[model samples]
Target chain A: MSTIDPTGHPNVHQTAAELATGDKTDTLLQTDGLRKDFGGFTATDEVDFSVDAGELRCLIGPNGAGKSTLLKLVIGTYAPSAGSIYYNGRDITDLAPHRRVRRGISMKFQVPSVYGELTVRENARLPIQRFADGEERRRRVDDAIAAAGLTGYEDVAASVLSHGQQQQLEIGMAAALEPDLLLLDEPVAGLDVAEREAIAERIVRLNEEEDIAFVVIEHDTDFVASIADEVTVLHNGDVFREGPVEEIKADPDVQRIYLGDEQ
Target chain B: MVANTTDGAGSADAGGPMDALRRRIEGPNTVGNSRGFWIGFTVAVASLVAYPLAVGSYQASRFSLFLVYAFLGLSLSVVWGYAGVLSFGQVVFFGIAGYTFGIVSVNFATPLGITAAFLLGVMGSALVAAVLGYFMFYGGVRDVYVTIITLVSTLVLHTFMAQTAGDEWTIGTAALGGFNGMPTIPTLALGVGGAAFTFDSVTFYYFVLALLIATYLGLRAVVNSDYGRVMVAVREDEDRTRMFGYDVKRTKLAVFTLGGALAGLSGVLYASWGNYVSPQVFELAFASLPVIWVSVGGRKTLLGAVVATVGIEFVRNSLGGEWAFIAVGSLLLVFVLGLPGGIVPWIHRAYVDARGDATASNPPEAETVEVSD
Candidate 1:
């Protein structure tokens, strides 16, 4: 697993093994039979999910397909009604949100949720200060801002930034934590083509440079194609299909259920 | 993965509703540069130092009582303004301190006993706040419901304290005095028999003033620290802060307990200065007053709370208690409707605006480089 290449090379048999009982060193996050129900309605059904270290994965699903619910479950915002989640092979199904964060899992919400009352630097500094102090904290904050391409805007308040800038700031805050797995929900949901492309590039660069894994939820297939090494299609609270982007795109079921049956 | 994109150059500016509030609470920009702040500081210090000397002894004691009341205002500012926990039962802390001080001082009647009473009152209030706050915060009670719980708690405590006026209510030698209240309480003093220095003179007035100043500066420092920033962050968004790896419940509880301890300190001072302790401290009407003082002064700003408490208490004193209640109600309504940020924030904004105008008329030298080679 350590010798396995991360260059998106196709190794069909190896991919299958990685999914079942992921290599402990390579798997950053995994969920087994994860289930969540609100009353009689099941928001997430029996689902097994996994993300390898340093791999950029995209989640695509139609509305009510449980993309958001699954993210919530993995991030520990909502405890699973049944089943368990593991981070780096350790059971984390019952951990509280903050404890999960301390264990090197961080998330950006669907909305641009940076600390609006704080300056860009301060917003990023809050999480970085959790593990570091003094000069180390300051350097990490600077690096995170620069990684998000927000170096010049660090002194400004988060609220004044444009929608795209606000989104980047939230990403910067998550980066400051230096997490193993970063979950992004609709990271570029409301942005112009330029802004979306800029954010998409930043995510890819961060994945490559920092060697951090990302589980991104996005509706834009074109954007997903640009960055995702693997794509998982969620439908009706379960994994409908999962594979490399090209393979999933070419699959008949994915086209019929998700790609509008046109392809 | 394949991607190539670049960020567009844009100005970095932000002042959301809470950012302005953050500025008010932290005073990050206003204190150092604003001329009005220095002027106000000077006037406040000079007046505090001189007021007792100029006034009659009886009137001086009343001024000291106001200083003590300011402590409650500061506590509410911390809990409600900074931490965003609206507590209606702040007076309970004050009452606890008042009763504790009265009991300890009356029974023990020594310098060590007096010091111990202060510590116990504060710690006792903190313990109570921690337990109550744990239930409210950890049990998922939030926002207006937290307010409701605190308000209801205040009423229950007031009723329970009123009932303590019966003959069996004596704790140690100190009587619970029912609604009539504890009277002729021993004034705060040092030394034992002959040389004991009592604070019954104008010296007590200065003592409370000094304490108020120290508490004000201490609280300002706390809210401005990294811990304080996170406290404000939690207030702004609990889930977001938690996502960043902070124990939101624990943070809220810490601030709640700190506020309670501050209120407790003020309560003891009130009992010491006025030489009285009573169920009147926990009356529902009085219970609601701290919120008004903090709201009118500036919810998140300590100095604003102190100024508002003293100013409003002054008005209440001169206008007589009943009429003062009516006046406070009217002022609260006006403040809530027109000046939601409170007086200090309004002043800060006016200062910023005025400074903006001056800078705009004469733009500063180009601060940003056109291009980096």
Candidate 2:
């Protein structure tokens, strides 16, 4: 028998039952029966999503599939209209953006948001200052800059950097905070193959070396397959399909909805 | 403040002539410590110190009035430039301090009374700013709304004060004299009880100059601190800064209150110098004057604000009549249209370009190589 639950998450009853029964102990971030409504319109409806500790996950969907909105809900940029969000096994659905940062969560937006007027070093210094001070602040800034492959451009203003470099600097600055989980929206979107490869390698290195969990939103299937351990596909704000990268790639349903197959 | 800005690279790297030149070009621009800045500061100080000796007492007294206005410009620089709070009601604090000092000094007519007036006037300005800032920031008022609210408040104050000319408007022993203003307000003096000695014109000029120097240095230290860095960051991007874990509202409130206190202190000096307090201090024209000076000089740089204030005032005094206003108004238009970054940034840009040209001849040990886009 098919059943519809009122709370919005496509399988609210099943998800709530699983959560109540403590079926997901290793989850670092979990959103159950999540729904977001704007006025009379529903933007994110009945979405259940989770990321495991030390896991690299990719979220993919067609345009208006509510992928970005889901990320905002997780980062507390957009308050969920309904449902609960738990991080590290504790409810943190109402924390403000800064409080979330203090709890070791960081995010990079689709457009590079580095301070254009500030020097590259200054950009690194701002986020690093929150975590370290004295000589340690300098060391971390240097390390982040080096990791981003921007050592020589330290004194130059961030506005002069090319698009890909700016994105690198944003990731490098986020890394300086030493966050436990990182959420990047379109990190390598619109870059050439070389630039895309450079950023992909950096992300893989950071995930493996620092043991940082990432939920990257991307449309590039090849890049996703290279980095993402598991993939989540959303269609009209419902989890259409989710599985290992290869299985999701082979799924005829995902291909029809996301891979542009005509019905 | 700027104490941690530099390492002793000069002594350690005291080597070839090329290294010496490069080091000189990159010296710490802390307070008035850069080579060019130090020279200009010394020259200005010497000239001001030698002014009373060179000019008549009347001229020196007039110059002292210009010094008072310089404080107004600096106050605006702190509030508007660093913190990004565009307050059109700065004259509100200035007027409060002037009236408060005048009323207390006239009513009590004692050293303790004058002291009480100064403390209360400055503190009262700070308290009012704190309350207003908290409401505006916490209430989530838009930036344009904040500016309009402050401007409207100034107009309200001017209209209210202008109506208080009646004899019924007496506070304690002092009358609110209305648009005609309260004349014969007591001058500031040093000493305890009633034994205070009044300062002569020359003495007062130096006293005010000393206060100006101290204020300039104190503000320099403030804007150089980590607090100052976060303040500039807030100005650059408020939401991005908030996400980075800084309390944007508290920083705005603190800087706003600090700016008010500085204006209040400036007002006390103005009241003392003029020996009068007036409702006209809250007038719209008076309120707009400091904005003009700071924008013309360069808002981001404190020295630019002071220099613009003093230089423009000196020309205004020389030109006399309404020509001063006309000249200042024309100059303000030119600056707003042509040099939006203001004079200081323009000068810094020119200096950097010249340095870059010089360094182009000899490649640096590590040059910035652009990565592939």
Candidate 3:
């Protein structure tokens, strides 16, 4: 898959992949002093965040934490009132949502947003149709549907699908974009244990085999531990803790703020 | 060997040549796709053609006026149905083009002048829609707010035009006759001096029918195309569609402008057909008619818009009294309450149910997976 090295200023000497490959530890996404205020309330405040290329990171937080807001800010759904974002080591704070998508950053919302009237095949085809067509488009759509475990429900309208299936279809739609960075807001929030396990494995394979970076906003701590290479815990618009999954899992403060609050 | 592999399969080509024809008409963007629907479509077109032949030229000409309004219905259908932008300003664009056509045609007073007016009127409406649509979509005005803004825009245009009856309101040779309307404006014409061809009463009626058919089928092809699929996707979920690398605002703007242009065509024809242009075109009562037509018919189906427009307009013209409004209003209420999907889809659902088609409301077989929250 081709990658868009979005630095806002094109004609840079080095491509994004080259930078990632050269160091093998270079940050793929970073935010500096990022702040977003909704009137009198601030959702995300003065946060410093980063994600490495091909890394699978989990963002866990208590209810009302700013994880989703941060994801929205990164995907250009929410404009930062202050601070900036850099992708591939260059500024991209002002990029529009669709332009960010073209630059290989995209997200699935917390809610199921599949086209209820459209079939599973058609829903997967919408994002894929933009970049590929004919045999390639068909192949990508097929892969996405199968990845979502929706192979037999190809012709069925998305509305009739079980809630878990609808959420899975949304994941399929997002994955069909084949972005460099995929941000999922509670992707497996509504799935059962079996479905959740299947989705976790698929996401891991995507990260490992396809080299797609992820920032998954999740509530399930066990699910997070199963997949996250690194974990970032957010509480009340601040990055409360950041470390490897084991470290996050063991942190007492993280437990008091997030893991312990699991009710 | 490959050809022989599935040779015993329970299928045969319907004349082999017609197989390709089957695919284009029945895409996922539309509601009606059954063979029964196509047979009904052919019969309807044949009846339309035969009706004019049976009637006198005057009656045919009057019926053609009904055809002119079909474009307005189709315009609203594209904007509100597919693009998910509820607008009452379809008539605003129509009035603009009608007045523009009248102004330009009167000033030039030549065959070429009439041709220029056609281009100017249609393009003018599209240009206005582009400007207005830009402000609405890009400026973050969305949903029912778009409906309000468009409705206010229509009434504003109506109030403004109604006051343009004074002497200062004249544009070149044409007078802004205000509520009185501009009368005796030259009808639509084509070509150059000596080689000019004019659309006479009979010809104009035929021309309008032909144009309506072409526009309907052309729009069908459009709705079934990839772009139309995107339009439907946008209507389904704007944010989700936008997240998938689509400039959602631009998509809405394009469809809105196209709708404006279609309404402009109707306006141009209306001005020429009646040899008059009026502020009455933008009157609240008249302006709201396209909404009624589209809603009572199926807004999602282009043919529904056309059918409802012509059918309602025919009854309205014959009724000629307050009874027409009451009837149309009652019909609109009935459809809105009983059949919210509108006539075409309602009939289509029945047809599909009767056919036992797989692309429908059937329970999934076996292997039931538990739904989770």
Candidate 4:
């Protein structure tokens, strides 16, 4: 199980075995039978999923596919109606979002959450100060600013940031926490090609160099295909298919749900 | 993580000694700047030392009143500025403390010193605020609900105090003092060696100044600490702050209590200076006044709140009557509409711009660079 490579695609048997025995290396996060319901409507059905340490996994499906809901469940933003979530071999089903973050999990919202009245640096410094303290807080804030390519614009009010830059600053705030698992919801939702590429490249570099795990929710199939090692497709609050980018892209069910009958 | 190597930058910018002086006068660019801390500290000390000597007895008494108002404004700043809780009932705490002091001193004092009466009064008021804050903060009441609940609480307290004054079982009448308020309240006594010193207007001014300075420094420390950062983060984005491992309710409660205690302290000084306690102190108008002071002063800066309190009082005193109200009201409008950043930000901005350095006009730009990894 330890020798099974999680680089190209997931090995379900190995992943399941590792999850059962509470193995720490391959799985940074695992969800078993996770479910959520809003009123009578089920937003997330019973689901099983895992992301290996240092892997970039993308969650994709058409609108109303429960991708965002699943993300919320994983981060404890929304408590599961049933089922449990595990982070690094520990059950964290009841942990609060901030506690989850302190346990090395952080999420960037689809909408930019930077303080509009504060400068870009001040916005980033807030979370840095929250998650890190003393010298490390200052250092992480500086590093995040640099990583986001916001060097000279520190004093610029967050309100002044272009939409793309605001998105990058949100990512910078998450990265400043030095999370083991970073969840990004539609990171490039409003970016131009250049901005999207810059963000995509930063995501790739962070994954390769820092060995950070990521669970990204995006509608851009091409962007997901470019960065994702494993892609999971959700449909109607259930996992429709899960496999390597190429295989999932080629799957008939995935094509039916995402690309329509013409495909 | 980059090591901060900008420690020597303050001295290395030898554009001239004047440049360094300009930077010092301009204040720190960041909310968390050590230079800003020192400048605030120096100014606070100067105000404490100088104010009592500069004013005559009448003005000294007025300045004492201004300091008490400043304390109340500071309290509002903490709850509204740091925790993002707008409390409309703060004056109830002030009134409660004043009435408690009046009742206790008039009735219970031969047994307890006037000092004991004062302490109990302040503590009693703080206790009431804590009870209210727990329900407001931890009971899931937020924003407008919190504001309305507090305003309602103020109305209830005002009615209760007014009724208590009219009741036979209560101390009643001039003892608690209904509409007219209590008089002949004892002066705060201080002893050096074996001699006891009674506070005159000059002495009261210095004493209140010391308390104000202490409150300022203590609050400044809290605002700059890790806990302070958490409180401000809560203000900026509560969900994010909570996601960062803070118990938002607990932080809010703590700030509310601290603010309440400060308000009570102000109440003690107010009763001392006026020699009075009355239901009128708890009126809705008095309750709403500090909120305006905070808004006009600049919500984020403690010094700004104090300056606005004094400035507004000065304007009100010079003009008097309806014209005074109009003048202060007009200035408040100008501050709200024309200078929303408040007087302090304008002063800071002018000082920075006048330095005539490239970074001076754009200090935030420099801060941005320091943040870049």
Candidate 5:
């Protein structure tokens, strides 16, 4: 039931249920001189970045600073005009979006990503059922829903969930694939302070327990400070700063442009 | 609500194929499935079988044409309503298949010929859809553009077919017909020579009705299956689905091609019924008619599509001329505005509400959704 093969790339399928989890030193995802230009406008201009296996990283940027664009680039939503993306030690720059997903890369959108009309179980089942079949699929779906802290809400329609719960459902759906890496775009954008804390806690718990590497694109400094072990700051389509979370938070340029402005 | 789909435990693992099929037919993926829904379905099907007993031979024959259109309606309902890919010109496939069946069956005029023609017509339309779907999806033609491209395809076919009036436009014994249309084509049949079983009006009505029932149940099960979940996912959000590891273009292509085959099946019936084929079938009015049928019936529900197609066409035939247009146009407005889920789902909500939500009766994690959206 392996939908993708990370070893050879290009949707070479093999049973991957027992896929070896790489050590933490392994760079799960990296971009080398990745550049994206929309007609004449460059959204992410030749930025190099990398994340280790099981790392929890946050990307912070001001408006038009390419945080979202970089995430899209990594997920194969946007093809870079120049440069390449490497995943699991293989060059995956030309891989299709679905192929990338099969290679254990999943992304949750900035928007309300839940299939609002589908029930929580249906939403959860879509990703798990893609690769896992029958009883195993059902088991994983139940596990993922419960893992997202939404076990009892399985029968409820996703649309009626509070804004924060909806986000958790989307994350749950994203995690149902058991992806090695998950990219989240503005996962806490529309939530309240308490709601944001709930989401942040969920993200961190998933990161440690599942050993799933995460690169969350957010503009919230306090949120990032709480959850992310490492942080990357972007400005004008380039990596403006990258370091351990606290050091990056203390970076003057980042505070002046993003954190200071937010305050 | 696509809600009860998660509770796979209810189907009882030790069922036979017939029981499995029954489970699929009565599955929670579709809008219907209450005990009341099945009872109504049995009653409705029984009535359809006995319909000719009440009406004259002419009315029965006329109603068969409406049954033919239900295939078209179901085609659109799956593609547009369930899959969320609104197609404005499903009838183009109908025309394509009708012409193919008319041409092949006319030249051979035998049971084997009709059988071959049926296969050719369905496969031919599906092939066209596959090719067109490939370009539209893979080339990044999305949303309204896909709708526009389909509409343009129908218009192109119409303009081209309408001009094939000359002697050079004949395919063997069959003429391309141009605007004049092909007539005197053989009716549908099966088996070879001495054993050939041909259909008259009453037989054909029963035959297509049986076919419709099988198709409906089969499709309900398909949508409730794992693949159906992906189809719904693709419909809900293309990009998000892609991120979930589905090659969405392939899913869209497959659905579009299936839809084409369904519309093509209707076309084969249409040609067999009338013994005629015309470029007028590809005209904008015919092209846009299925959209209205599915929309007014309930785009999301198969029952809605079939019922709406037959009921609306009957109403149109009875009302006649400008009055029919006014009535259909008015009905469409009412459903599109007031009851966007369409008549069947709307009625379904009332029934479910009256019965008190199905999940409310369940023992655990009971949640009721008022499905207004």
Candidate 6:
């Protein structure tokens, strides 16, 4: 015990070291004091977050809590005004969104990004072919198609898919990139119970089998509780609380935020 | 995702023939892929190669001009079609490259080899365009900025050429031949056996045809390459392209320079055929014409651009003089308004539709089941 350095507690140090490795290590992503401002308005305050390898983390916040803005910042869709983001132990704070995707990160938008003019498979394949090449690309695309539960509906135009199916197809499109980290912005935001469960189960299964780290943003508490290993609560552009699902649900602050103080 | 689910259930129940039709339309292909594309390509090439021989000398000569325009249109297609950059000043490169050849052969030296002159013209135009593209593309210019910069640049070059045509230290505007253009510019000479043949109308037709074929094949190769894919991706989403580890500006500049070189090549051919190089070549009217050609043709398809050029030229040549402009202009309006996808895409669509293959309208179904959470 005396021989072991006190500064480097094995369990805590290992976790920290693992996180420090960023996207390459067991930690898929890490954000440090990320901030975003729009003129005089602060859209996202300094935020520190990390997603472990193959972990499914859900971000929950009420309206105007800056969840989407935070996601945009993470993807480099918006430049953060302050702090840094690391992917694969590389500082990617200033990288472009597409570059981030190319670096093994892919995101599904809150609204599906399917091309109405193109069929579902074509829409998926366009990005796949754009990003991938040779046999690996073909395999990934085929795998993603199957994974999305869109086996027989590939030829259907994206515009023609059911709402649930569209979301699944979008996930398939993102999955085609074979990303290490998948960001889902309210993937089940507007789906029915069955559809929500279907998507949630898919996310859990993908996490387990594909070993993909996921940072999901959703307002639905039940949905977040269902899939999340860790829940980060955002409130008014700042993190209100963060912990395990049970701990987050038990927090009085979170309950007050959701049900109001009087209640 | 939950909020909108209930609304879609009613529609799901009502799915009838439309759903069946949709399923049929969405099914996978049973036939092989390579056969159709190859057959179509072969037929197209055969038509292009045989047209001049079938139609005789005068029509063939006209076809040569059409080929030059096709090159010009293809040049603009890479810029406007694949890269989503609109250039109204492409004719400047054409004019410049033509002038380069004319000046080199006429004033500088009469015996300057054709190959040497052509190489010089192409290189010079490409260099100028690359430099210009660097400024325009990397300057963070978009839509209006691109339009104004290119337009102003063309006007500046045109005026400069007009003013400098007859200077004492210069090649002398007389050498440039001013507005009337240089006449009797020598044609390419092909050494056959122990003798050389002066490229006459028929010979020049083949010469231009060879160049056209080369241009078509070369451009096809380029467009099918990784570079071409990047260019298309840039066109689809520039921000996304940039994020994907590509310098969008560099890609744009490369496309622009390549396009310019092709345009210059067309210019060289035009100068050779017409035996002229004039400031009028750089004028706004001529500069804007190729854009129309690309629009009237299918933008993404190289074959479509060539076909449109030939088709438009044929329409113009048949009508004769002033009436040709009116007739062609009216036809252009009809093509632009009614057939925005251009003749080729429309024809392709009609052919596919007439074949009555349901899967023709959709993509193949997914084949496996990997994840069902």
Q: Each predicted complex: what DockQ? A: 0.33, 0.27, 0.49, 0.27, 0.43, 0.18
Best by DockQ: 3
User: What TM-score quantifies how close candidate 1 is to the native fold?
Assistant: 0.88
Calculate candidate 2's fnat: 0.25
After superposition, the stretches of candidate 1 with alpha carbons farther than 4 Å from their true spots are A1-24, A255-263, B1-36, B190-196, B357-373
Across residues B47-140, which tens digit of lDDT does each residue of candidate 2 receive?
9999999997888988998998888888889888887888888888888888888888888667667777777777887777788788998787
Candidate 6 Cα misplacement greater than 4 A, ranges:
A1-28, A96-98, A115-137, A152-166, A189-193, A246-263, B1-56, B107-112, B143-148, B168-185, B189-198, B221-230, B240-250, B317-332, B362-373
State every prediction's TM-score relative to the real structure. Answer: 0.88, 0.86, 0.92, 0.82, 0.91, 0.78
lDDT of 5 by residue, A1-263 (tens): 23344467756432221233233337778788899998899999999888888999999888899988999999999889998787876678899999999999999888876887787888888888767877888788888888777877776667667777778888888877888999999988867898899889889988999899999998877899899978998988999999988898777777788744644
Q: What C-alpha lDDT, on a 0 to 100 scale, does residue B86 get in candidate 1?
A: 92
List the lowest-lDDT window of 10 residues for candidate 1 chain A. Answer: A11-20
Instruction: Check candidate 5 and list the clashing pairs.
Output: none
Candidate 5: residue A15 lDDT (0-100): 20
Give the top-scoring candidate (TM-score): 3
- Model 3 Cα lDDT, one tens digit per residue, B1-373: 0121111111224456565555554466676455556677789888878876899798999999999999999999999999889898899999999999999999998999998998899999989888999999999999999999988999999889888997899989799898898998898898899988899888998889999988987788788777888999889888888789998999999999999999999999999999899888988888889999999888888878998999999999999899999999899899889988789778767766666665466737523344443
Q: Over 4 Å off in model 3, which ranges?
A: A1-10, A13-25, A259-263, B1-22, B366-373
* Model 3 lDDT per residue over A224-245, tens place: 9899879999988989999888
Docking class of 6: incorrect
Candidate 2: stretches off by over 4 Å: A1-23, A32-35, A38-40, A89-91, A256-263, B1-33, B194-200, B320-322, B357-373
**What TM value does model 2 have?**
0.86
Give the better candidate number (2 or 5) by TM-score.
Answer: 5
Cα error of candidate 2 at position A167, Å: 1.4
After superposition, candidate 4 runs with Cα above 4 Å error: A1-26, A130-138, A259-263, B1-55, B107-112, B166-184, B190-196, B317-334, B354-373
Relative to the unseen true structure, what is the C-alpha lDDT of residue B259 in candidate 4, on a scale of 0 to 100? 81
- How many angstroms is residue B55 displaced in model 3 relative to the true structure, after the best TM-score fit? 2.1
lDDT at position A98, candidate 4:
75
Q: Quote the chain B TM-score of every prediction.
A: 0.85, 0.86, 0.92, 0.81, 0.92, 0.81
Evaluate model 4: give its lDDT. 0.75
